[model samples]
Target: MIRKLAIIGVGLIGGSMARALREEGVVQEIVGCGRSKPNLERAVELGVIDHYTHDIGEAVRGADLIVLAVPLGAMEATFRAMQDHLADDAVITDVGSVKGSVVEDAVKVFGEAPAFLVPGHPIAGTERSGVEASFPELFRNRRVILTPLDNTDPQALQKVEQAWRHCGADLSYMAVAHHDEVLAATSHLPHMLAYSLVDSLARMKENDEIFRYAAGGFRDFTRIASSNPVMWRDICLANREALGGMLKRFADELHGMADALEKDDAEGLLEIFERAKAARDRYIDGVE
Candidate 1:
């Protein structure tokens, strides 16, 4: 059992994890660290944390487990500040969406001092943020992926798995490179497309028409586009290579669609739409 846990960010995901673990008695104590005093205080008031601190090192002082829950861009800075204070036997993990850059940046901070650092990503999030947006069961039934490097400690990796399992999450192990490639297709590229489409539409003279006549499909498609811009921007930059590759593939498919439309290829268009419909239906029915 993890007796002490320190979370570097007390926003939606971090706060929710703190609340979930504490509610389930998975951890005896949780210290939330963030720049906002009010956010930290609100987290404590919500019973999500046992203590709060603006000082990163102070908050993680004696924690047996440390979760770097900030934005992907903030990983390096956060790790640098907390590296000096990590407990000798602490197992470090993160809730970053993109793992490749995080793992690469964090290795130096952890050093070769028999440290156990595991980079993890949870394929789950609400379209909300901040301390007020958290709930105890946010990760319940969600898939949590841990991307461990070659040098990761077996015992430490197991402990990280145990923590996620205790949070009611299903676990999967992946390599950092493969994780980025898979996520580029399943998550990042879609978000970028959504943001692009929304931005393009928002620039139209009849923007109101697009939003006013939006159906459920439009709403669902653009939901992630409404996510925090700063966070998403950092993710795009951090995982630019894989995202760029996916974008190229998307462009190729788009050219095919354009060609079909230009040539009045009704059969091709129908087949394309059918493929999309079949794929979406299967996903909706949880067939995948």
Candidate 2:
């Protein structure tokens, strides 16, 4: 049981976890820390957490469980800020999307603390950010992937797993390196395409009313592009190697698509379409 839980960052993911942990009765006290006092107050008003403060040290000093819910970009700074205050037995984790950089940062900052676990929870998030956007069920029924490195303590890892499971998430494990590579292919690349496509459309938005006529497909594809810029920017830079590789592959495929159109290669087009359709079907089936 978590006697005291400190969540650093009062945004959607952090606030949501605070809400769930409080409701589930896993933690006796829930404290929130953030740069914005209004956001911290909002979380308190929403009853997402039991307490709040802007002092990272005060919030995490005696916490048995500390979660850094800030953007991936702010992770290292938060670690440095809270490191001196973290309890010796406390298990620290974050909800960052990218794992490799997170684990590396944790090792650099918390090297002396063998009980630390820099586990990540990549529950599919909404484009919505900030405290008001959080809901207790955001993590429910979501796939929370935890990337545990080799030096991570098993007990610490299992405690974090229990926390996520208590929040109604399905747990899965992967190496941080492997997780970044896979996400670069699945999540990262799709987000890049979404951003680029949406940016192109935005440039043309002033010229014509294309958005007014766009269908459900366009909305679905552009939804991720609407995500908070700073967060996505951090993710892109943090996992640039894999994302760059994926981008190259995407560009090559784009040229292939252009060629398929120019050559009127119906056989090639049909084959590509069939393969993509089959892949989507498989993914849908798995979810079902």
Candidate 3:
């Protein structure tokens, strides 16, 4: 059990983890750290953390487990700020979506990937932010991927794996590059498309009418567009290489569909629609 767990950036992801750990008695204490003192104080008052601090060094000083839940862009500065305060035995982990940039940042800050520093991503969250939006059940039945470096300490890796499991997440392991590519295609691309579609529609001449007539499909598809812009901006920038590649491929596919429609090619349109529907059904069936 973690005697003291310090969670940096006590927003939805961090607050959820703290709530889950506290509920499960997996940790003795949780210290919430963030730039906003009122947010951290509110987290404490909501019982998401035992204590709150604006100082990263103070929060992580004696923590055996430190969870970095800040945005991808903030990883480097946060690591540098808390490195000196981290215990030698402390196991460091993060909940960043993009792994390649995170791994690179770890190397830059520490000169190498420390055995105790584990890069992780929890594939779960609502289109919500802040401490109040968090819930203990956020990670329940969700997938949490860990990308461990070659030099990672076996004990540290196992401890983090166990901790996520305790939080009700199913664990998986992947290479950093592979994880980045997969997430770029699966998660990042969809979010980008959603934001673009919503933005385009909202700028139309009959914008209010368009929204008024919007049905369940538009609402469901653009739900993620309501997510924190800063977080998504950082994610897109962090995984730009993979994300750009995926975007190009998606654009090619869209162009093909448009061409088929313009040419009045029923077979081509049917082939594309049928293939996508079948693929989506198979994916849903597999997940279910």
Best by TM-score: 3
Per-residue lDDT of model 3, residues 68-146, tens digit only: 9999999999999998988878999999999989888988999988899899999999998999999999999999999
Q: Name the weakest run of 10 consecutive residues (lDDT summed) in model 2.
A: 110-119
**Which candidate, 1 or 2, would have the higher lDDT against the true structure?**
1
Candidates ranked, most accurate by lDDT first: 3, 1, 2
TM-score of every model? 0.95, 0.95, 0.98
For each of the candidates, the C-alpha root-mean-square deviation to the true structure, in angstroms, is: 1.7, 1.7, 1.0
TM-score of decoy 2:
0.95
lDDT of 1 at 226: 88
Clashes of each: 0, 0, 0
The lDDT, on a scale of 0 to 1, for candidate 1 is 0.87
Kindly list the per-residue Cα lDDT of model 2 for residues 119-147, writing each as its tens digit: 68656678999989988888898989987
* TM-score: model 1 vs. ground truth: 0.95
